[model samples]
Target: MSHSPAPRRRIPAPRPADGFMLLLEAARDLRTVGAVAPSGKALARALTEPVRAQAGQPLDILEAGAGTGAVTRTLIPQLAPGSRLDVAEANPRFAHRLSELVRAHPHLAGRPPEQVRVHDVHVERLETGRRYDVIVSGLPFTNFSPHHVEAIMDRYLELLRPGGTLTYFAYRGTGRARALLASPAQAHRHRAVERLLAAYRDRCATGRRTAWANLPPATVWQLRRPAYAVEHSGTRAATAEGAGGAGGVPGPAGVPRTGL
Candidate 1:
């Protein structure tokens, strides 16, 4: 008699020391690293919802501030063939970790190396000329100065193709905590950043969702770039590039070019 074959066990994504690394990074630089823990699976799902919604289409995706590859792991499995993902993490150590994740990601097996790349640079500084269909941001906007926050938001919108979506999350209760524990100056700065963000939300917000299962809970906001802006920006970028302006900055030494 022929014996029945057993099913293959699914191999889980590599997640060694993610939480510990996040905590250490946070302790070393809370302003940049932002969170004390890696983002939970629920939050990752919420952030990658746009990608899922656009399933089967080859897309250009950008992930800013990918910390410890929490969302990256969730994203890799969802990428359709011919889709490209560019991960920008300003933290060098985090960028290195993300590179490792991209290499070991089971879903990325047999794919070209150019399909996904980790850039050790700030999203605003990423000079890739390609615009994205979806942009997922894991940056801590609340911790930045108002000017910095505005710059990053501007960069995000510029990097998105017309009608493209950008998803980002902010932990719940942060405003209350800032008001209660922060000094007057810090609280004032936080309020300023909020107002700046509020203006953008008022203009471009497409949807909002809350991830309660995440550590400390979080709210994910989705914004779409106005289709009209693309034509104008494209003209300006072309002009700048034609004039040999600083529209594109060179990547740092030892950093691989994304070639997007």
Candidate 2:
């Protein structure tokens, strides 16, 4: 009697470093690495909504502070053909790993690897000449000083094309934790960043989403730059319509042990 043939199995996607890499990087620098675990699937989806919404268009996208390609996985598949993605990570290891992930990503099969670039630099230092239609940021804003966050935010807005959308997340309930676990001075720094973020949220925020399924949970905000945004080389001008600051923390301030 002839035995039945075994069924074929499909190849699966390669798993990137994910939590392991993020944890290692965090150990190196909690302030820069931020979280202990990589972003959850739910959180990744929430953070990438702007890129999803722009599907079918040849868009220019930027993913800042991408850690282990968590959100990058969700994003690359949604990019319309001919679209390009630039990833900025402050950690050299993460950046190198991200480059490898991008090279092997199935979504990039049809296009050259040049479509995706990983930059080992802080988001603020990325080249300014190129503007993006959508930006998904994974930076840990709460860990940073207000001035730095503001500068980064300004750079993000500056890099956006008119009417572009920016999406970013902060772990929920981090403020209270900071107040309890940190020195008064450190706590004060945390508070300052919160206030700065609040200012931005108040002005330009279009909407927010909560991802309770994540390791420490998170809130994603979508902010828009005014369609008519125009910057003169030198001028003391106010921001344009729909192009203001973002909103404040939605709930309890949290200092989460989660990674970007």
Candidate 3:
């Protein structure tokens, strides 16, 4: 007998209670929460654009710092059959919430049980040998020190397979806002992070988009790994210098949750 393929799943509206819990978490620990509110639908869509572009092909995906699963909800439905998604969150509370989200998400109901997975540790500690085709990040780079940011970024590029994409967002006006209220030392840290990011942007950036419908407007950037990912000239030596190969993105000694 011949039969039609199952219809694609539609996204469900977020629940009020979920939003409330997210707000509470953010209030309790703004440093790890990233935003006071869950990622708006528009922003979620923007961040998941890379996955949509790879429709019909199986892929390995990673979503780091998924504070409340707003972005997770959008990402799961877009994954092609046989695709794998690993969500890494450092905060135990947020991680628990994400685990629940994965179990209850309608779109993931009939897929392979392992299609979606969550880790309660930092992204830097995720234990995986598979190279990812895409990585969607929700971490707040501005919250951590420059060295931490660099390590995280380096780990991300390393985990990606050749020509893979990495997407992430930063709240709009953060630079100006920080300059006005941050201490001189704090401001310096932000500058150092920016300079580090600028170097990568110059080398690997593909495109960027502004999502205005979010609480605090944000910009999403997409960067592609060089075609020769394993042998990129500049990064080859660095990746060899005792860098945590595949299972982890080693943190600087004494640094906790380096960038996730």
Top TM-score hit: 1
| Per-residue accuracy of model 3 over 77-127 as CA lDDT, tens digit each | 787888999999988887888887788777787788898989888887788
> Candidates sorted by lDDT, descending order?
1, 3, 2
- lDDT at position 142, candidate 2: 82
Q: What is the TM-score of each candidate against the true structure?
A: 0.84, 0.82, 0.82
RMSD (Cα, Å) for all candidates, in order, is 8.9, 8.8, 7.6
Residue 132 in candidate 1 has what lDDT? Answer: 98
TM-score of 2: 0.82
Q: Candidate 2: which stretches are off by over 4 Å?
A: 1-17, 230-260
Taken over the whole model, the C-alpha lDDT of each candidate is 0.81, 0.77, 0.77
**lDDT (10s digit) by residue, model 1, range 41-154:** 999999999999999999999999998888998998899999999999999999998987787676787799999989999998998779999999999998887556766887
Model 2 C-alpha lDDT per residue in residues 30-115, reported as the tens digit of each score: 98888898888999999988877767989899999998888888888887888889999888888887887787676777587778
Error of 2 at 64 (Å): 0.2
Instruction: Evaluate model 2: give its lDDT.
Output: 0.77
